[model samples]
Target: MFKRVLIANRGEIAVRIIRACRNLGISPVAVYSEVDAKALHVRLADEAVLLGPPAPGESYLDIERLIDAAKQTGCEAVHPGYGFLAERAAFARAVIEAGLTWVGPPPEVIDLLGDKVRSRIAMEKAGVPVTPGFSTEEPDMETFEREAVKIGFPLLIKAAAGGGGKGMRVVNELKGVREAVEGAMREAQGAFGDSRVFIEKWVQKPRHVEFQIFADTHGNIVHLFERECSIQRRHQKVVEETPSVAVTPELRKQMGDAAVATARASGYVNAGTVEFLLDKDGQFYFLEVNTRIQVEHPVTEEVVGVDLVAEQFRIAAGEKLSWTQEELSQRGHAIEARIYAEDPAGGFLPAAGPLLYLEEPRGPGIRVDSGVVQGVDVPIHYDPIMAKVIAYGPDRETATARMIKALEHYVALGVPTTASFLRDVLASKPFRDGETQTDFIELHFKEWKGETDQDRQIALVAAAILPNGVKTLAQNGGEQQSWRQPTPWETLGSWRIGGNS
Candidate 1:
């Protein structure tokens, strides 16, 4: 067990890691940029160090600075929570060279699996089915063109070292291959510093499913079942659920076994996810491997009743896995909705402003993981995700209903959010029938505006009441002094007793 651990990230994930460390009796050390000096994660950690300016290149993404901070803070281990330096193999190696435990997979494994082309090859060698694709160190346009024709139309041009939908493009016809390939190469170079790109046949109506797998240094590995992440926009998942309604008991076993095999082949350790694209015919193909804890891990934790973070710590400490495959089983369905500070009406552009008023829902089977607090400024310098709302229930219907209710009650003022859009998607007929696919958002929501009469009414009421010195609903509980002086109603404007005006 580590006496102290440095969390080299920010936002809700940092806060989440801080709580996990505390619960395990480990003091958490947090690092934050100048803009995040007053962030929730910094406030909650036992100790915090200033990184640099607001820019990620100078702050959170600085590997050398992160290592120095951990060593100087007397941290025995470093936990890179998801983004920033989480999947950077070089960072993990740096942490190890500094004599601090890295709470993730081995650096060599990260390097191998980080590259999409190499990972696909590894999965194939491990007997896991992968989509037909072309990969070459020296990318020749002619070679790519030939491969595209063999793979047929509607091929995907993807970065060899990409995630989050960046550096990716879809070519529907032969005429678009050259333009798509060149564009993908440029984007991939800018985003990942790797100019390598590959082409794969795009399976139509594919459901994005992922299996969470854990491995210990002792060579023990097990898969924690699957998460249905097909509810996406721009190739990024917005909503994720566990025990996918699409994956049956038999299909679960097959995918779980394949996931475990893939992890073993890559010499993986700690936590990682094996993502697959499941077609309508129930055939699944390996998509990619995420070498760090996923953002949607909570849904798996809710159903499996396992504290994944704790397990990560245990694995990094060289302890054997606590639970065996036989001991673990899914209990119920869980759904997670990412609440980002973005406007769905404005083409889902990121919105940044002070969270004038913020309220998160709470109740049985509902969990809210957040980093922002009321009055906190959401800067434009980072990801716009403000929080995650997760709900668990005995079945999918109940979980879906709970998520809708939770999204409805969630409130944030001074900045628009995707809460309403998430609610609409959950209530839509396709989602209700479990007809989720990779193109769910594009197929159903193209040109779909989110404007609603309820939103207008709420805005009108808020505008009409706020100027009258009436505090917003979220601000009513605390002791507040009215900024405005006595109004006409409070002074001499009120009717006498029951007399009419």
Candidate 2:
């Protein structure tokens, strides 16, 4: 075990790594940017180091600064928790060269699997199903259109060097292929400076599923089942769950075997996720591999009853996997809803303001992983994700009910959140019946407004009793509370909302 470990990240993932380190009796070192001086992760760590400016490039992503911080803090290991430099193979190599343990996969695996094109080639070698695609030779539209025709219509022009829908576009028709390909190429070039674009057959109405795998230097490897992450907006997964309704036990085995094969093909180790796209006919094709612990990993942990981060630690210390595939079992269903400070109705514009009040839900089956707190200033400098609310139950129905209850209990002020919208999603027939797809948010829940008067009766009750009753009620307009602020719900008691603004 490492005497000390440096967390080279920020926000909820930083807090997550700190907790894991503490549980393992390892002193955790937290490195923060100027904007995160008072961050919750920094507050919880055994020691804190100031990296640089508020921008990620100047701080969290600055390899030299993070390495110096780890060395100065006497950390024997560096844990890149998810985002920032977590998936960067160069950072892993730097840590190893600096004589510090990299609590992640080997650099070779990161470099190989992190690149989408190389991963695709490796997956094909491993016998995993892959979509047909053509890698761009240069930032030229002529070459792009010719390849698109070869791959057929309805092709996806994607960034070869990045993910998260940053440099991706879809062309359903031939006329749009030229423009779409050029646009994707420019965007990819600007974002990744690689200019390389790839064309692939775009599957229609596919369910995004991914398996979590862990391996160690001792050559032992195992998977922690799968997560149905099809519920997304703009290609970014917004909602995720364990033991997908789309995957059966037999199907899971097939996907799990392919995931392991993909990992082993790249000589992967530590923790990673092998993503796949399952079509309507139960056929799944390899998508890409995330070379780091994912943001939605908690839902898998909730069901699998094992700590993946701790496993990363053990693996980094030269220990084998603690369990085999047969020993691992998902106990229940788990669902995660990512709450962002963005208006779903207003073009999903990011919300930035002081978080005047934040009251997260808590209970037997609920878990909250948050970044901001009461009185915290949510700026426009970064991703607007406020927190993640997860609910666990013995089955899917129970989990849905618990998630609804938890979302109802959560209350925030100042910046607008999709909490109310999320509540509506849970209550909708499609979501309840598990008819979710990648386009579910836009197809059904995109324009969700909120609940009615009957919905705020308890909010009125909470307003009637909460310590800041008057302020809470006044800010949100309860049944009998004062209406001072011009909130969206201000005139709910007076039957007014400006005819849908």
Q: In terms of lDDT, which candidate is strongest?
A: 1
Clashes of each: 0, 0
Residue 142 in candidate 1, Cα distance off native in Å = 2.2
Q: Give a tens-digit lDDT track for model 1, residues 1-501.
A: 888999999999999999889889998988888777667887787777788899999999999889988987788999998888888899999999999999999999999999998888888988999998888889998998888999998999999988988889999988899999899899988767888999999998999999999999998999999999999887889999998989989999999999999998999899999999999888999999999999999999999999999889989998999999999999989999999999887788889876767889998899998988775678789888899999999999999999999999998877899998999999999998998998888888876688757679888997897756855433543323222343433233112223332
TM-score for model 1?
0.93
- The lowest-lDDT stretch of 10 consecutive residues in candidate 1 is 489-498
TM-score top scorer: 1
Global CA lDDT of candidate 1, please?
0.88
TM-score of 2: 0.89
Q: How much does each candidate deviate from the true structure in C-alpha RMSD?
A: 9.3, 9.2
TM-score of every model? 0.93, 0.89
Q: Tens-digit lDDT track for model 2 on 229-335?
A: 98887788878999899999999999999999988898888999999999999999999988888889999989999888888898998887989989999999999
Residue ranges of candidate 2 with Cα displaced over 4 Å = 450-501
For model 2 the local lDDT of residue 309 reads 85
